[model samples]
Target: MDFNKKVIALLAVALLATGSWSCKKIIDEAPLDKLDITNAYRNVADADAAVIGIYGQFLGLQKTYILQNELRADLVDVTANADPYLKQLANHTTTKDNPYVDPRPYYQVVLNCNDALKNFKLMVDDRRMSVDDYNKHYSDIGALRSWIYLQLGIQYGSIPYITEPVEKVDDIKNLSAYPRISFEELLTRLIDFTEKLPYKEVYAYPAGNPLVVTIDGSSTNKLFICKPFVLGDLYLWNNNYTKAAENYEKIMDVENNNTNINISFNAYKVGYYLSSDYTDQSVRYLRAQDESTLLVDAGWRTIFSAPNTSNVWNIEFLWGIPYNANYKPGNPMIEVCSSLYGKYLIKPSQLAIDNWNAQRQYSGIPYDARGKLSYSTTVAGPVITKLTDNIVPATNFNRAGKWGIYRAALLHLRFSEAANRDGKGKLGWALLNTGIANTFYVGTYVNGAKSPVSFDEINTMQTPYAAPYYFDARSNNDYKSPWYRNTGIRSRAGITALDISLQNNVLGLEGKLIDEGALELAFEGNRWPDLLRIARRQNNPAFLAERVYQKLLKDGDPNASAAREKLMTPANWYLPFDWK
Candidate 1:
């Protein structure tokens, strides 16, 4: 053979082999997907996979522009931006041309949920899954569907409860073949389906030490947050607050029974409070509420770092979801670090300092029954920039090279100082009720530094958060002079520990939180469709006003004259609504 010809021939052979190898790799990398229902619905594992398909609905449930995030469009302060999504929602009589304002995005959640349900229903048989678990999973899917529809109704005011999968293109040839369901009727069905569904119990216990049974009553509390009957069960949307409170109270009772989210009630403790006790750990009341729900594990992380927190029951929750995220949009403390004070170590906001001084009252001082502060801050300034100080910081997990924020603690989870006192003054101020202090110290790791920070320069921010320290003329009625502290740790440690605060707040972010649209659940993926359903945006003027005013007080109050002047108007809530 000619030398040139042999070279060309060898190259061709090598190319063919490489191409073949690539093809094999793609096939191997694909999910163990068996889309054909007819061929595979005969065994337990097959059933598991089929059910897994339904789980996809939940995949984006917490992700953006889907059900949860979409749902935030309705409430006052759920989304970061709410308008553009509203534009897409085609409210016929309204000027908006898009069907869902945030139309296409929400439908993705709905469509996927419908597809999962329809496909699973069609292929369901005795062969593909374990009969018992299969039914449970099936019901779980139904529960999820009911929630999706409920969100749809809330967003669009009407929706077609699509039951069957669009098996073929011909099914839509006649336009009238598929009709829309009214919001009222869909709402009823949501309740109907949710009624019979059993809670899908999935217990997640810490490794090795299995004796605790789930910290929230084992698997018994694994209930749905958005079941059909949830409307009647907890009441929702406009006029739902009262019943919602009752439902939350009911949940508290149940959780208490399981000893999952019990507040520390032991009478024998001395604190600044004459008779007070509370746990710092909190929960969101979503799914799988348990005793350990508030105990944020060093590993399990969530959207909130525990600062952007609130109660579905107004203020009954143990913790609220803060918007702090480590590598994403924004992290409360870490992001704050990038601010003038956090970045330059000019000192945390004066607001945060005030808040810290107020909270410190309970640690070493006292409070009276009439909601009066009975003591003062013995130690002020930079009360606690890190959560590790609140709990026994974990000492177990060490450096394999990865930076460790928290190790592990033998202490039960706690949120604010109140977590330890529980309505009786064990720590300091007597428990008038389960109250959380608004003040905390914000010290600096390095005094007045810029860009790179030293370990001792970390600081905190608090302005009007503190309780008045006496009749000092400098203090407002609800204000306290903020204190500062110099800490040995870095801001990273404080921020990382905050992540644990949110993830473990099953008590506040209880596993049973129902109807949490993406607004409050923004980015968390629980609200999109619901936001669309309500025709509201997460950061709508009204919403942002509330968030800035209440939910994100730490971020700053939107009601401030400066905030109003700078960011007033619902338009700020608008987004691109790019479901296209």
Candidate 2:
């Protein structure tokens, strides 16, 4: 770690931060002296530019995040043409020299965030920045830093939790000062840091705010890291089920009005459902008759390909990083997963294909439409085309693709995971299978007698949960209600509901939730984390190892046994923390 190289990296960040936005003129007009930390944060505009610059540095993480999270999971496998580095990841035999194993890029973002957090506090104390702006920007950066640290711990196992700004490159090499902490300790630190933040809301900029950058006619407001999602995820990993559910419920309750009159615009709800009538493109989808006639409709795929302006797309995606070909950091996923115009480095595993194929649609159809919609069988291999579909024909390049961070399906599935562990297995099962409203309102018979729904259940279903830790899904014959709109994760996928008996078996319900997360979130960079989290929670490393083993066996890999053996040990699950 040369000092000159560190200086060059910081300078590069300054240039990138200044120019990353679509409206480059504002950043370009800033005085060169303002780029320095000493002069930066003197005003609101300067603070905004500094935060935007941090985002520019974050763009470098897109490739590593997906590779580390997906390549090592059960859903994704490397192609024959993939680099040896990628093959090592899939085989769980990563070397120190593997480029993806380098943790400097992750630390770079953390360092930037550390610098910004310190300066923001000073600005607020000096009255240079208002409390409102300080809360919004400070929490945004704090959440971002916590998220990066979490990713580091998840991938590298034990990592040095460095909070102070590293003025010199050599400072990081002194591990004696900042000792590496276990993932459990890291979670405790993050939960404490995130829970105490002044603001927990999304950073929604005003109409004429300079921070609002429009990319290719689509306005980008989802750049900031979601604070509640971060806190929820931290609590989830730490095994605080009730606290996790509470934080997640906060995000889901964003659009809920306190009134009893239920309206339809709940962005947090998984409102998409299958329909034979293809009149409403937003909420309804036509089921494919069979495997051969599986139509890739705009309904499901639009979650990834649709523009940010789309209401349906907005409802699903909570945070996304916009990419443009003309920009410095172009879309990395296109080159990684695309077979048509890109490298075709990796493809979906046979296990993933089988998982999707085994599912029966709501109409009892054999195949899951999401499988075909997510990827396609090509001459080369089964290429994953989820985010890489919108390619520019003129340039033969992917003109745009969003790196999605959080979404409704992932949120709901995670909530269900927490709820099940918190002894709310019935509520968890309903969200995972059918809508909450449908489950409670349509009461089942108990020993020839129709079980009466409780008053609290009925009230919550009809009015919808606003505060505390209750959830509602009953439409009460009014389809416009937000609770009624939630058709559950499986229902949105046009899949049949799981048996009601499984709800009582808490462990079984947890397993089903993980399975549903795979089918829904697959390559969105959540499979590995979801699997790892549950395995750790249950204290069963085999839970994760067996799945990876099965995937390897399905692919006919000779090293499947060895890989499974390695993964059985909790210590071997994380990448080596060898990078200085």
TM-score of each candidate?
A: 0.39, 0.87
Candidate 2 structure quality by residue, lDDT tens digits, 1-580: 3443343344333433332432122222333433345776687767777777778668668889998998898999999889889989998989988888888778767877888898999999999999988987888889999999999989988899988765543454553356799999999999999988898874445445556555454555676677889989999999998888888988887767735323234567776443411111232344445445444445677777766656656667778766664554467787788776678999999999999999988667776778888888999989898867555442554346677889988999999888888887777887888777666664555784334455444454542333434665544333345566666888777788899988789889999999987788888899889889988988999999999999888988787999999999999999987764
- Superposed by TM-score, candidate 1 places the C-alpha of residue 41 at a distance from the truth, in angstroms, of 3.0
Worst 10 residues of 1 by lDDT: 398-407
Tens digits of per-residue lDDT, candidate 1, 313-350, equal 11122211111111122222221111211221111222
Write down the TM-score for model 1.
0.39
Tell me the whole-model lDDT of each prediction, alpha carbons only: 0.28, 0.75
Model 2 is weakest, by summed lDDT over 10 consecutive residues, at 276-285
